[model samples]
Target: MNATTVSRLTSFAPAAISVLAIEGPRTLEFISKCWQPNQGSSVLPTNRIRFGFTKATDNQPRFGCNESIVVCRTNHERVELHCHGGKQASEKILETLSSLGAMVIPWNQEPCLLARDPIEQEAMEDLVHANSIRSTAILLDQMRGALSRELKRIEQLNANGKLQEAVDCILQLRQRFAIGKHLIHPWSVVLAGPPNVGKSSLLNRMLGYDRAIVHEQAGTTRDSLMERTSFDGWPIDLTDGAGVRLASEASDPIEIAGIDLTLQKAREADCVLLMVDPFSGWTNSHDRIYQETQGKRILVRSKADLQKATSVPPSLLFDAQVETSVMTGEGILELQSAIVAALVPEAPDSGIAIPFRTRHIELLNRLIGL
Candidate 1:
C-alpha cells in the first residue's frame, strides 16, 4: 500500500499525446510533489481529470513552457497523467517521478493488478494499446466483468457437481478465446494463387476500395501487401501474397522469391483463398499450391464472369469452393462470409465472456479437474 509504482501507460509510437499511470497508496503524495493542479491544490478527486503542469520533485516548475496536462484520478491510490505525447514531455514526467524515488517502469512492466480485480485490470491494460475500434469494444465489455462473472458462475456450477453445464461453459470459453486472443494481432488471411488469377482484385473487392493494385500483368505483385479490416466484428489481417507458379512459367528470380514467400505465408495463415481463373479450368499449379497450404483453404473460381467451363470438376478435390468476380462483384459478400466462417467457425456476440489470456482459461480448466 505504501510502495508507489509509476509507468507510462500509453503507446510510445510518436503520437500527439501520451498517458502515464501513477499507482499505490502514496501516489497522491508523490504526485503532489511534482504536479501542480490549476486550482492550486494537489489533492485529486476520484474519476475527475484535473488540469496540471509538470514540476520538479522539490515542488518547483521545471520550466516556463507551461505544459497543459489533463490528470485523471481514478482513486486516491491511482492517478493518470495525460500530457503531450512528444518525447520531451514524456521524458520530463518520467524524470520527475524517478527523481522523487517513485518506481518508473514501462506499461508492460507495471504490476499485474491494475485495478481492484484481475479482469478489470487486464481489460484496461489491453484498452490502453488497442489498435482498432472493434478490439476496444470487446475489451470494454470484458472490463465490465463479463468474462470474470462468467468464470465465477462456471466455477460454482462445477462445485455443485453440474458436470454437463460446467463442461459446456469450459468449451464455450475455450472456443471464444481464440478470437479474444487476437485483440491486438489480427487474424491473418492470405490471398494466394497463380499470377493473374485475380487475387489482388479479390482483395480490393473485399476491402471495398483499391487497396491492392489490379492489373493484367502477371507477377505484378512482387511482395506481400497487408490490409487491416474487421469482418462481422472480428478483426482480420488480409495479406495479398505473390502468386505461386511453376518454374517454367515464372522464371524471374524476383517473382520466384515472392512466390516462395507466398508459400510460407499460406502455411501460416489462418485461412487461404486459393483463387483460380474458372475459364482456365483446373491447372497443375493449382493442385501443387494447394498441397503447400497446410490449414483451412477455400478454392475460389475467380473471373467468374468469364467462365468457359461446364462446371468445377469434382476431381479438382477442393475442400470448399466459391465463384467470384471482381468486376461484376459477384459472390464477393458470400466469399467474405465464407472467410469469416472459416477463420472463426463460431462468432461471438459483443459482450460475450471469453478469456483473453491463457492463464485465465488454464485456471478454469484446473478448477474443472479439481
Candidate 2:
C-alpha cells in the first residue's frame, strides 16, 4: 500500500479490534470451532487472540464474502469477535454468535457508559434537523456548552452574592435570546390593506415569485395565502391576507367575515405591512385601518412608478416608509434590507441569548422574579 493508505489503515487498526462479549452455553465450543484469523498470532492462555474462518450452519464458507474477523477470549466463560460494518454480514455474525448462546446488547445500552450531557444531546438533534448553515452553527455552539457555560458563570457570580450584577447580565442575555429565537424561528409578517392596494403584488415581490393571485378585482383574494421567505438571513413567514374594506351594500357575508379575520390576524402578527398606493396617499379608510393594528406597523407605498413625486410628502409622517414598484422590481432590495434592519438587527458584542423554546422563556421569567 502507498504511504497515505498505510497511515490511514494503521490509524483505524486499533479501533477495528473491538471487543464484543459473547456469552452463552455454546460460547467456548463455537469459538474453538469457528474462530480463525488469517494472521498467525500465538493465542495466550486466558487472554488469547485467534485468527479464524467463519461458516454457516450448512458448512458453506462465509469468510470469502466477509473479511476474516479476529476472535479473542479475554475471560474463561466468554469470547469476543471483531467483525466488519455491512448490515447483512454483521447480522449473520450476530446470528452465529447468538446461536452459540450469546446475548446481544447495543453498545449504547451498556451500563457504566458516560451518558451524553443534555446540551450535547440537544446539539445532536439540532444538527440532524437544522435547515440552514447559520442555525446549524448556532446549535452546534450551543451544544458545545456556550449557553450552559454562560448560565454556570451567572450562577457562580450570584453565589458570590453579586445578585444585582448577575441579574443585569441575565436580563441583557435574555433580550438577545429573544432576537436569536426569532432568527432561528422566523416571526410572522402579515400584509393587510384595502383591496387593489398591491398587497398581493408586494407579496409576489417579497417572495421573488408569483405565489398569490394579483388582479384588479377588489376581493380577488378572499383567503389568506402564506409563503416562507428569508430576508438577510432572517426567516420570514409572509402572509397575504384578504383585503380589508368597510361593509358595503354589495359586500357578501363571506367577504365581510374575511375582512374581519384579516383584521384579527393583523392584530396578532409580529409586524404588519400596511400597503398603500403612493399616488393615492393615505386615505381616511387607511388611517382607520392603521389604528386597528396592534403590532409593529410600517407604511409601504406601492406603485411608486405611477406617483408624480418619489419623495414622502411633508404632511405624511410615519415611523418608516418604503416606496416600491412590484411591476418593475424597483426598491425591492431596499425594502428587504429595511425589513431586516427593523426586525432582526445584528447581535451585540455582549451577545444576545434568545430562548429557543417557550419553556426556556418561562423558566427565565421565574428566575427573574426570584
Candidate 3:
C-alpha cells in the first residue's frame, strides 16, 4: 500500500477557514477511515466537495472528537480538507489522519511533489505569502505558465540563431524584476525629520488611521513604528522613525539612541520622506538629515495650513516636494502619488513575464552569454 501524505496548506494565523491536502495511492481509503459524510456514504467521489465531520477511529476512542469540515476529492489519490482556521480544528484532523497511517509533511514540500517545473514550484510557494490583490493576480499568472511560456520562447529564439533577439528579450524581462522582487517583499519607505515636524501626523494620515502617537511635544515618538500599507495595489512598508534632534539638544540617553536609529534606518531605507514644518522652516539639522538620505529622499513641506503660500526652496527640493496639512486633509493624495512615482514609475502591464526569484535572475544572467 502506498503511504498517504497530508499537509496544511494555509497560514496558521486565525482566519475564517484553513485547507489541508492529502495525496497518495491510499489517500481515499485513509480519508474514508476518519471522514463521516453528513448526507451520504463516507466514500467520496472524484472531483466533488462533500460536507462531513471527521472523528478519530473507534480503536483510539480516548482521542475521540468531531470537527465540521468539507472535503474535495481531486482524483482517486488526492483530496483536500477545508476546516475552520486555527490550531485546534486542523490539529485534530491532522492527528486523526496520522493515526490512520498518513504521513504528515511540511506545506512547502507539497509543491515540489506536484509541480512540473522549478518556476511553478517557486510560484506556488510564494503565492501563499502575497500580501495584496495585485500581487496575487501576478503570481497566479506565473503559476499558470506565464513565465514558463516566456522562457520557452527565449530558448526557441536562441536555438534559431537569433542571439540578439534573445538577449533583448532577457534585458526587457530583467527590467520588470525591479517591480517583481517587491511583489512578495514590499518596498521600505522611512519617515525621517527633526523633532516636532509632524512625522507622526503624516504617518497616521497616510495610513488612514492613527498608528503612531501624535503629540505636540518635540520627542513624542522615541521609537520606530512600522506599518504595512499599499498604494495603487503596490505593497510598501512605511516606518515612522523617532524625531531626530540635535545631539546637544537631546539630553536623555534614550532620546539620543532613537535619533541614531532614525539616521541609520534612513540610510538603509529604499526612500525617505525628509519633512520640514514650514512654520519652523528648514534648519541646519534638517540639512544634515537630508545628507544622510541624499539620493532616495523627498522634501515634504508639512503644516501647510498654518503658513502663508511661499515657493518651495529650490535647493531642498532635490527629488520632489509636496505641501501637506493633516488638519485640513490637503496634499495627502498628491503625496501618495509622489511616493508611487518615486519608487515605481511604471507598473508592469498585465500578463507580462517578470523574473521574481533569485534562481530566475541567475538563469537569465547565464543566458546572456548565449
Top candidate when judged by lDDT against the true structure: 3
Count of backbone clashes, every candidate in sequence: 1, 10, 0
Model 2 over residues 50-69: C-alpha lDDT tens digits? 76656544343453454567
| Stretches of model 2 off by over 4 angstroms after superposition | 1-114, 123-134, 309-317, 348-353, 366-369
lDDT rank, highest first? 3, 1, 2
User: Which pairs in model 2 have colliding backbones?
Assistant: 36-51, 36-52, 37-51, 37-52, 176-352, 176-353, 176-354, 177-353, 177-354, 178-354
**Can you tell me which runs of candidate 3 are displaced by over 4 Å?**
55-59, 111-113, 309-313
Q: Rank the candidates by TM-score, best first.
A: 3, 1, 2
What TM-score would every model get versus the actual structure? 0.83, 0.66, 0.92
Better of 2 and 3 by TM-score: 3
Better of 1 and 2 by TM-score: 1
Which 10-residue window in model 3 sums to the lowest lDDT? 309-318
Question: Which tens-of-lDDT digit does each residue in 1-370 have in candidate 3?
Answer: 6578999988788799999999888788777777778886777889888998876686556444677889999877899999989788888888878877889998877733565677877887889889887788788888878898899999999999999999999998888888889889988889988888999999999999999999998889998889999987888899997888777788899999999988888888888998888655777678778877744678888998997653445665556788899999899999888898888888777887888887888888888763
RMSD (Å) of each candidate, 1 decimal: 3.3, 10.1, 2.2
Q: List the residue pairs that clash in candidate 3.
A: none
The TM-score that candidate 2 achieves is 0.66
Candidate 3 local Cα displacement, residue 266, angstroms? 0.9
Give the Å error, residue 350, model 1.
3.2
The alpha-carbon deviation from the true structure for residue 154 of candidate 2, after best TM-score superposition, in angstroms, is 0.3
Question: Please, what is the whole-model Cα lDDT of each candidate in the order they appear?
Answer: 0.80, 0.64, 0.84
